[model samples]
Target: MLRRSFLKVGLAGLAAPGLILRAQATEQPRPGSPFIVTYFDLPGIKGSRDVTDAGDGTLWVCGQRNGTLGRFDPRTSQIKVISLGEGAAPHGVVRGPDGAAWVTEGGQNAIARIDDKSHAVRLFPLPAGRERANLNTPVFDKKGILWFSGQNGIIGRLDPNSGKMEVFDAPRGAGPYGMTRTPSGEIWFASLAGNYIARVDAETAAFTVVDPPTEGQGARRVWSDSKNRIWVSEWNSGQVSSYDTESGSWKGWKLPGDKPRTYSVYVDDADKVWLTDFAANAILRFDPLTEGFHSFPSDRAGANVRQMDGRSGEAWGGESGTNRLVRIQTVKPA
Candidate 1:
């Protein structure tokens, strides 16, 4: 495994010449000793992009290619699917405030909420008269209102209580992808095309951009630690960067391998950063305490585990390439 370290990046690429931190290191991929991986077959539900807790032992997933939302009980290996109607290419699924699965439906050009049991579907179209939005992922703010991203250069908020939905254009367009709320309750999202992550002011719907250290390092996904610092996965540069919100500093490390393609990032309860390397076809773990990278390669080939979320005990992932939901139980090394 190869590693690179850089810190104290200036905002908007404005700094003394050659002041940017640049160094590289290597790490060996972790073998199958301390990790126990189990997979649940999501039969017939292919192209899963994201997963979220169903508020039960089960998990809800987006069947991106099949135009459906699926609920899978990992304990029993039972899966239930609900058709979001034709042309409903759902991209992200998260449990909503009402204890239901909310979907960003790009195919239907709307936001959808589905009952956990009855699976009844309700569509909330992007503010009236607007063209179809290339919807991406969603995250809820402290007030229970939903904030979402659209790859078509847009962001929006939905008030479930009042059925009021509004859309706003991102500062830089056409790449608003993954989104996560900070511990301080601020919502931030990544701009894949724009190469920056921006924080959203929920009340005003304002976006403030945070640039990554490396130019053209596609900011594909963003997650926050318990301390409210933002962690972002840079797709183009194959690195993970952290923004210390309080100090206004940045630190970044590249994923191991010659051509690591970082697709998703999640920070678990233990403060360990989890990432999916598409090029290596494995889930990589980064321990902040040790500043080391560990790899947990999936047993099945091409287990493209995109978009994961952490819970109290474990982290869940949707293996889109294999059409399965995987739960990883890691034994901490002594």
Candidate 2:
């Protein structure tokens, strides 16, 4: 397993004005090869955070501002908004086995399910008094049980069939954020406030937490590769890291540029990691095998692309600040 590592290079050690000038000259976005930008204006989407492909060409987008979920049809370019009641504040969206799209409503502290065909919405309340149930990412397991990490440091399982809920506590204020399951059926999640990656065995309900190598750089999101390694993004540190399940070792790569705040990370079918630089207003592609990095800026500065989904050779992302959906198609090398 080749783990990519990117370290901050140049200028930090320099004390002279001439060295500072030379570093600035080399740090500009590449010149003249135009990066195409096609924006789809999503009305009433003031705080779009996550976008998930429904595996059928349509996309499910969640809004953090209004607790609304919008469905976008790529082929027809039509948009449909489903209200999850007042103050739902949907943050993450994914397709479930029931053929409906499931969303985590952060504001109202609940999970919601929306029918793809009928556009009907059903809300599932969290266990009472669990305020941390807000800001969850729901993942369906192999046995069809829906697992979610609550923002306030709790993990819960919701039985979609019976609507029964079971909850477990994480470290106090861990702020469990993005999550993914391994091929072996263990769930791994980022502990944003706790600054670690926590794992839970599906069968035994046992939990373990791995502290990140860099302090003050809490884990924000996670994704799994085909080889079963878990990759996590350190939002505050501008670095990405990988954890090997087989070897039980961790490795990391720092991002390019100063203060690059990565919000979401995804591994495409080709196994390359794609990151959205929220602070720098750019999208970065990292080849894990080569440790090669390529970056392209969003059309507008501070576009704040929060989440992305890769499908069919294209990457689709939600731009929160711009109130639009962005598509990035791969350009084959000549």
TM-scores of all candidate predictions against the true structure: 0.88, 0.86
* lDDT of candidate 1 over 25-108, digit per residue (tens): 122244655765666667657687788888888778888988877877665666677778767789888888789888888887
Number of the top candidate by TM-score?
1
User: Candidate 1 regions off by >4 Å?
Assistant: 1-32, 331-334
lDDT of 2 by residue, 1-334 (tens): 1111221111111211110000001122334543344567777566777898876778888867866777777667666766667656788888998888988777767677777776677767665566646666888888998888887778877788777777777765657888897777778889888888888777655678888779978788898887788888898888988999888898889888888787788887778888887777888888999998788687776778877776757777887887778876665224
In angstroms, the error of model 2 at 28 is: 18
| Candidate 2: residue 277 lDDT (0-100) | 78
Question: All models: lDDT?
Answer: 0.80, 0.74
Supply the TM-score for candidate 1. 0.88
Per-candidate count of clashing residue pairs (backbone under 3 Å): 3, 2
Quality of model 1 by C-alpha lDDT = 0.80
Which residue pairs in model 1 clash with each other?
A: 1-27, 3-25, 153-174
